[model samples]
Target: MTETTAEIVLFDGFDELDAIGPYEVLENAAQAGADLEVDLVTLDETDLVTASHDLRVEPQGTLGQPDILLVPGGGWTSANEGVRAVVEDGVLPDKVDACYTEGSTVASVCTGAMVLAEADLLEGRPAATHQVAVEDLEAHAANVVDERVVDDGDVLTAGGVTSGLDLALWLVEREFGADVASEVSEEMAYERGEVFG
Candidate 1:
């Protein structure tokens, strides 16, 4: 069986659910025998990062080129540290662009779409993001959509916090099989929402 590696990018002020929801779904898929390796990674040298809700997470390692790169949104609405800070710093976006160029399937959860926008990856692409950041995404020239998840070929995006689950389940189904995705959702007792491609 071919092994697929997935990295969920974690940063300071990232929403807990945005990262953890997909992490759990992928972990369950791995448990169900999907030939997948899932990891929580950071872009900086600091090891322990705090979430928006004050939840602390120790990332496995620095971001690397993975088969799937998952970006989670956090402080996009506010002028605080989170998506906005990452965008301004430009390091994360540059890394994301490099990974994408290297054939990583880029995905975003919630306002994480803003980071993709910064990388110039979502422009003219049908994507979804947190409702509050929809206009901002549009300003970046993205064709925003209303759905739990939007799949535009290699670039996938999901709306709001809970939609990360749907995005992850979709990835499991797309990469592995429907049976695996169904088994993962059933294992998590999660009912997936609609996915617009």
Candidate 2:
């Protein structure tokens, strides 16, 4: 396979679990000698990012061309605004759109799939996001589904909050092997649920 690198994008009000759950799984896969590297990235110039829950994290830098580019979503908080803020701003969505020129696989967790939709990435594709926002996704012309994960070629999407773990584990399992993925899942004490295509 090609060189495996994952870039997890973070914005001002990203989701904590949506970003971190997948990070942990990919990190564990790297630790197990999977030849995969995972990095937290952002479209913002500053390295620091505040999650929707007000938790702060520092990204390495802006996004780089990687084998995987994943977006994470957080709830809409009156104070933080989370994915709503991202949708309104369109900065991160622009960057997401730029990644399509690269050969990496693109994916998202929760309403981050909405970010992909906003970027016009899901124009005629079947995708999945948080079920609560299915209407919003459909508005963007995405064939939204209720499944936990939906894979459409290079564009993959996951549902709700916890499904980030399942998506990441499935990615690891797909690129590496069931054994390596199982080990990472066991390390995380997480069950890798069914991933739909």
Candidate 3:
């Protein structure tokens, strides 16, 4: 069987760790024989998005029906406002719903949960985000789950930035096997932490 690929969505001012952590975990999972492919994508095919710390990431492609869509978040300011606008304009909602209907997994990290909520994807759903953004997540009617990672069936969420790694590892365990997850964690020296179901 062909391995499924996951795409991490990047936007201007997105938190670097929010995207990089999960990327690292998934990459490690592939090395551990999980057969997972990962890519960094953006709304535009060629434009480069700048991270919160001024790091630039040029996407390989536009988000095109990815098997998994991971959204990352950062501070809400002038830089992020543009990205938020794109998300709120129904782009994310439409894409996320389409992916979900196609049996693709959806997830978010840190304030990325806020973007999911804004897209109305988290309405009345239990999810996790950065502790600092819990209020924002709640504003969209999502039950704030306090944990490094929250697995609610098809939708998963990770708390804060570094939790993306945990979320990715958990997904590997779910889609492949616990042994693969453990091996990946061992390779990265990442201790498997508690996850909220």
- Of the candidates shown, which would achieve the greatest lDDT relative to the real structure? 1
Name the better of 2 and 3 by TM-score. Answer: 2
Candidate 3, residue 51: how far the Cα is off, in Å: 0.6
Across residues 1-197, which tens digit of lDDT does each residue of candidate 1 receive?
67999999998999999999999999999999899999999986676999999999988998998999999999987775899889988999999999999999999999999999999999999999999998899999999999889999899999999999999999999999999999999989999898898
In model 3, the runs with Cα more than 4 Å from the true position are 77-89
- Least accurate 10 contiguous residues by lDDT in model 3: 76-85
Q: Give candidate 2's whole-model lDDT.
A: 0.86
lDDT of each: 0.94, 0.86, 0.81
> Per-prediction RMSD in angstroms?
0.8, 1.7, 1.9
Ranking the candidates on TM-score from highest down gives: 1, 2, 3
Per candidate, the number of residue pairs that clash is 0, 0, 0
Using TM-score, give the best candidate's number: 1
- 1 against 2, candidate with superior lDDT: 1
Model 1 clashing residue pairs (backbone): none
TM-score of each: 0.98, 0.93, 0.91
